[model samples]
Target: MTLRDEITNCRICAERFAATKTRHQPRPVPWFTPTARVLIAGQAPGLRVHRSGKPFTDASGDRLRDWLGMPPEVFYDLSRVAIVPMAFCFPGYNAQGYDLPPPKVCGQTWHDRVMAELPQVRLRVLVGGAAHRYHLGTKAGVTETVQNWRAYAPDTFVLPHPSWRNTGWLTKNPWFGEEVLPALKARVKEVLND
Candidate 1:
């Protein structure tokens, strides 16, 4: 069987969120894109995204939109940028008001295939340890600290999760504001214009 099909039958994640989630195809995301210049690697979707069937449709998405210096119209356009998280669905909630970690099966089964279709990706924003762990294992540190961004590849900037919970981190990491944002914007403009 094709690897993509095997990913659709993922019982590990299905045991939780999928049981209660609205019915649809087994693998819910778009899965691939060709016009994408930048890829945003986040954790799993929250309930909002699962319901909307659009990744990053919540407060976190608002932060990401701001970070990209783009509006909702542009940001949602899959032809421009791609949002492929470590997990695809709403993994349900935990006590901290945060969603659970994305299922390992999703990443282990699907990411490389999807990435294979996105050869033009000039940048990939690895947001959390889940993404950082897989995409930049040896290249970037595994501790989920935003400070280890430089250890990853060029055009790929690792970021702390953009949830409002990270407000304090953003405040503490002024270099992320002073250095990374400008560089990010510059690269974003170059990609969009190309």
Candidate 2:
């Protein structure tokens, strides 16, 4: 079977949170097309995405689209953009209402196989610290990685999560909006046009 087929049918880590079964389900939400040039490598699906079976369908998604300077039609078109999170499923929330980190098993089990199917991904947008860690390794923390965007130019762009939780970070980092954003949008358009 193709990697997509295998991923869609996977239940390998379903039992990771058997105790939290009452709160969440293992619905692997991933979007991709083998020919997609731009890949949005984000964290796991949030509660909304897991419920909707769409990778990004909440306020965070709206903000992400804004950052990319793309309309929903173009952003959601898997033929051009691939949305593959570090974890395929929602990893459930904690008592404080924040989502738990995606289980390591998800990456260990599926990333390589799924990535193999996406040979055409030219510009990978790492959408959060976790994604940066996985794709860019321990080269730098999120702040440093994102600050040094030029190092990964044309091939990757590291970004903070677009969730409301990071509103303060965005406010503090004016350069992200002024310098990084324009470059990000241009790179995205360039890759898609390729």
Candidate 3:
């Protein structure tokens, strides 16, 4: 069976998820194809995404798409864009109702394999601290990592999470919008249109 199918049928986190406040089942949302040119490596799915079974189906997605200057048609096109999160399943909420970090086993089991399948990817967009940490192997906090976006630019763009929870962060770091995003949007357009 294909890797996608394997991931779709995965139950590796069933018992672990069954113990969360949500007590939800593992619903892996694997969205990618070999021909994809852009890769969006994000944190785990939010509850809305868990329910939709589609990556970035919430307000965060809307913000991310705007950041990329991409319309939904292009952003959702399997042939051009791949949305792969650190964990395919929602890890469920904590007692405070915040999303738990994605289970590491999911990445440990499938990340390399998924990347191997996408040999054509030319642009990678790392969203949030989890993706930044895993993909860049950086110990810096999200703000610093994103501030140094130039080090990985033209091919990769490290970004803060687009969740509304970070609105204050965005206000504090206006340069991210004025500097990083314009360049990122241009690069995204160039890469996807190439």
Name the best candidate (by TM-score): 3
- Each prediction's Cα lDDT score? 0.72, 0.86, 0.95
Pitting candidate 1 against candidate 2, the one with the higher TM-score is: 2
Against the true structure, candidate 1 reaches a TM-score of 0.82
Q: How far is each candidate from the true structure, as Cα RMSD in Å? A: 3.7, 1.4, 0.6
Ranking by TM-score: 3, 2, 1
In model 3, what lDDT does residue 83 have? 97
Provide the TM-score for each candidate, comma-separated.
Answer: 0.82, 0.94, 0.99
Candidate 2: 10-residue stretch with minimal lDDT: 16-25
Worst 10 residues of 1 by lDDT: 18-27
**Cα lDDT of model 2 overall?**
0.86
What is the C-alpha RMSD, rounded to one decimal, of candidate 1?
3.7
User: What is the Å distance of residue 95 in model 1 from its true position?
Assistant: 5.7
Find the candidate with the highest lDDT and give its number. 3
Error of 1 at 48 (Å): 1.0
Clashes of 2: 0
Per-residue lDDT for 68-100 in model 2, tens only? 988999999989889989899888877677788
Candidate 3: count the clashes: 0
